[model samples]
Target chain A: MQATPALTVEHLTKRFGGRVAVDDVSFTVAAGEVFGFLGPNGAGKTTTVRMLGTLISPTSGSAIVAGLPLSPANGVAIRQQIAVMPEAPGLYLRLTVTENLEFFAGLYRIRDRARIPAALEAVGLQGRATDLCGNLSKGLRQRVALARALLNDPAVLFLDEPTSGLDPVASREVHGLIDGLRERGVTVFLTTHRLEEAERLCDRVAILNTTLRTIGRTDDLRDRLFRKRLLVETRAPLTDPGSVFDGSPGVTGWEANGSGVYEIVVTDAKLAAPDVARALVAAGADVLSLAEQRHSLEDVYLELISEDVEATR
Target chain B: MSGERIRAVVQKELRDFRRNRFLVGTMAVLPLVFLVSPMITLLQIPASTPVSVIHHAVGGSSLLLFVVPAVIPPIMAAYSVIGERDQGTLEPFLTTPIEREELLLAKAIAVFLPSVTVAYGIYFAFALTIRFAAAHAVSAAVWHTPQIVAQLVFTPLIATWAVWVGIAMSVRARDVRVAQQLATLASLPAIGITALITFRVVTPSVRLAVALAVVLLVIDIRAWRFVSKLFDRERLITGSRAKPS
Candidate 1:
């Protein structure tokens, strides 16, 4: 039997006055999967997270978080099972790091006295446990917030722009921490503007723009949205690379580089690479190398967002 | 209501309250004046003074006692939710498992305890000062009369009413300054009515004291209900969007 999904959001929406912030957004996160929610500013990423986290009630539709259905009666239970680290670190600046964690542990009713220290250690904040959150730097404050979020050992975690405004080293530290959470079978629902971070950590991602545009595995999205490309290098200049690709079944178009290189858009690079190489050699051009080019998640994201904008317009 | 969560929020608010110099100064300085100034003025009155003068002096001191509970709660409770929002702490706090009523009550109690305590403490200090300093002139029965009932019964009720009003404003007002101003304004009606009784502008009788306490209690209940209803988690989060990022 398949395991139950940790979170299921169906047709969730939120409206502020007459303006709809999140419109009919829907998705599900499986147990222990790192699911990324990506969108531009004002695209309802935070709104959707807020609804799932039980911070705000949905204007319409429903969701189930950690087996508890999202409703007014189940808000407390849903909050108990999931933790959200908002876009801001949102730590008590005056309280010490240990105090902050202990306070939340108490709120979570985590009776284990050792859990406070364990949470601190989990976030690598044991050394700064006694330091005032106000005295700590931005990155350290984020760590404290993470420690607080882990106080309950929640089944599902919501991290919104976790690494935003962090230096490279601090961002890496957070990435490493998230990696550790995934290894421990924690379901992480992450919202971020950084495509690279999502591409690196998320098992699958859902691109949202007030509504969900697409949801699938990262590589799968790239495959579905972008065509394959193959680069061919020859020992001599391709005087007429178009001639080689003209009648090719799989080749859609070709562009010649200055000297011995040519870039070809193909229906399937894996299937077309060998054929193109054979055709180049047959055409009396010595084929130096043939390689396939993979598109990045950023490309797919930009392509989707621009398409969304154009369609809306 | 979860007792543990309420306790945690109360503890954290208290810890933060300690760090605020302005609030601490107001809590300390204002009560000091109200408590000590009455004693000083009572001490200056000669023992040879008439009974009417002594009664008038005690009545005047009782008015100062009313001021403590009225003023302190607004200063503290007004800052509770809005202060957290200003400090960028409310968002994470609301995401926790703690219920909304638990969070609001914990904050209200955190402000309520110190405000009422200081008020009553000052009243106790004033009574002691009057007993020791004006021993020959003022009778102990004067202190033990309706003023004691006012301190024990009416002060807390009024303080609670003020706190609930402050919390209501804290929930509705986006700016902490605006919340504080509104709370201060809300405390006026209660304080004004109490002042009338203390100054003999309204008759000081046990029945009047009981009647005032009952009325304040009713208002306190309504204020609590209003605060609980006004504090919308969505509004608090979305309202901050209008603030300069």
Candidate 2:
């Protein structure tokens, strides 16, 4: 039998007064999956995390987090099964790293003294456990927060903007730690505005702009929102581009983009490439390069957000 | 409800307080400042002074000591929740499994322990000084059984009231300074009642002191429950209340 998903949010909505922060947001994250929640500022990504983390109740709809129904009654049980690290590291600045983790361990009611050191080790901060949190750099503090989240050995970990303000080096350190979490098969629900971070780290990402704009694997989203295409670069422009490409198999249309470059719209790049290439040779054209075009997650995100902006206008 | 969680919060709070220069300075300075007036009042009492004058001086001195527990704790307690919010820690702290009641009680206990300790310590030091260093009549007036009992009984009760008031203000106020100022202002009423006992508006007797202690205890317990309800996680996290489903 398949294992139950780590998170099941159905029509989860949160409104503050007349403003709807998160509207009808629903998605499921499979066990051991690293799911990214991406959005712009005030896009309700944090609010949705707050709801699933049980820090706040939803205005409407429901969710099952870590196998427990999301309700006030199950808040403690659900919290016990999951961990949330907000954007701020939130470590008590005066306490030593070990003291911070020890305090959280006590709250988790974990009798084993081993988890503290283990968590510290997991973040590669074992050597710095004796240092005060205030004395640590921003990167090290973020690691300590990650260690605190790991103390309970939670079933799901929710990280909201885990690397919001860090420099490149610090951000890279955090990215590496997240990659390690993925290796351990931990179910991680990451919320971030950095598109590249989501693209590199998430198995699937959901983009939200108050409501969920789109959600799926990055590749799948690219495929869903953009048509398949091939970019052809040649030594010379086709003397008759339409005659060379009009009857080609799988070739829907073609556009001359630049000097000796043709952007061919295709049903399938694989099926169309051979036919188009053969036709080009017959037309006495010199083909420099031929490859399928690729679109980054950023393209898909911008496309959806621009559509929303236009609709609003 | 978990003791471990409560202990964790209390432990973290105390550790944080110890390092906080403002809190340490407030805890140390307020007791000494409140103590000085009482100590001077008791010390200046000459053996030749009238009985009534000595009684008035000692009663007034004793009343001033109540200010320590009442005023000092509000500053600390008021900082508790709002301080967490100011430092961007409240969200992560609330995300834990600890209940609001446990968090408030632990914060109260953390504030209560030090405030009550300083209040009692100052009172004891004052009483001992009066006993060994002051005039016989003044010392006797200060050492009266009902007075000593009232001091012991009401100090924690008063501190408890101040703690709850501060926490309530912390929960509701948008700014830390505003919360602390309001909490201090709100806590004066607890001391005002004690002042009535000092001035004989409410007679000073063991029976009356005990009865008043009971009343304050009930109010403190009820205040804790009310503050627990006032602690809206949704409001704290989002700066707005969660709409009802």
Measured by DockQ, the strongest candidate is 2
- Distance from true location, Cα of B143 in model 1, Å: 2.6
Per-residue lDDT over A204-284 for candidate 1, one digit per residue giving the tens place of the 0 to 100 score: 999998889899998889889877889888888976777888767799998887698888999888888878877888899
- What tier of docking accuracy does candidate 2 attain? medium
Once superposed on the true structure, which residue ranges of model 2 sit more than 4 Å away at CA? none
lDDT of candidate 1 at residue A307, scale 0 to 100:
91
Candidate 1's docking class is medium
Candidate 1 residue runs with Cα over 4 Å from true position: A240-253, A278-289, A311-313, B139-142, B200-211, B240-245
Clashing pairs in model 2, backbone N/Cα/C closer than 3 A: none
Q: Count of backbone clashes for each model?
A: 0, 0
In model 2, what lDDT does residue A44 have? 95
